[model samples]
Target: YEEPLTGEQYRKLELGPAPIDFDNTIQSLETQSKIVKLEVHYHGHPQERFISLDEPDVSLLSARQLEVINETLERLSSMNATQISAFSHQDMPWKATEDKEIIDYELVFYRDPLTSVREYE
Candidate 1:
């Protein structure tokens, strides 16, 4: 490991003062951030589960589509009893489809055509 630079040393090298103090830097580097494990249960069957990098920085569906995708995946995994079987084209948002529709990501779900219902697989 490289030795920690002193304030004078940083200035001599034309580097700005460290953003964080040495102790804080060590903690930040050594300690892993907390992870939230989420599970979605459907009909008493396991569906999906996942580890979140953070609680989730969510609000804008159009801007942060990846987070939405990750959340959807987690939701699918946590379901206890849904059997999603096949993939339908991801629901791409179409202005014609709805007055104000937002289609960011897509995943498959099991649907009974007869009953017209969907379940997680």
Candidate 2:
């Protein structure tokens, strides 16, 4: 997608690029009873899991946005966290940003073919 599906800004971190407000957003959703958060241990590391209490209100998203989101999920679903992080680190947006800095969404336009989702004429 040309634009981000959500307004949340992503930051370049040591692991990869991640939405800065992800934890807060998830907490808010949990508080609102829209979802439930579970803490679990994975390979001796603490991990968080969220379960939705109700269906998401997709009315806010355009058809193209929904399609893009689904396609992205499908593409990444098979990858584990470590692999996904490594993949994201190779993208221009993450590569161009300094550690702890906010990644520029516009950098996506300059992505290399392997990381780019759109075709250029």
TM-score of each: 0.20, 0.90
Worst 10 residues of 1 by lDDT: 8-17
Off by over 4 Å in 2: none
Across residues 4-120, which tens digit of lDDT does each residue of candidate 2 receive?
778889999999988999999988998899998899998899998999999889998998888878888888899989999899988999988999999988998999877877755
Error of 2 at 72 (Å): 0.9
Model 1 per-residue lDDT tens digits across residues 2-116? 1111221111111111223445544553466544335677566755444546665455334335554565666566532213221221222121123223222121122234222
Backbone clash count for every predicted candidate, in the order shown: 23, 0
Could you tell me the TM-score of candidate 2?
Answer: 0.90
lDDT by candidate, in order shown: 0.34, 0.88
Model 1 bad stretches (over 4 Å): 1-34, 38-41, 51-84, 88-121
lDDT of 2 at 58: 96
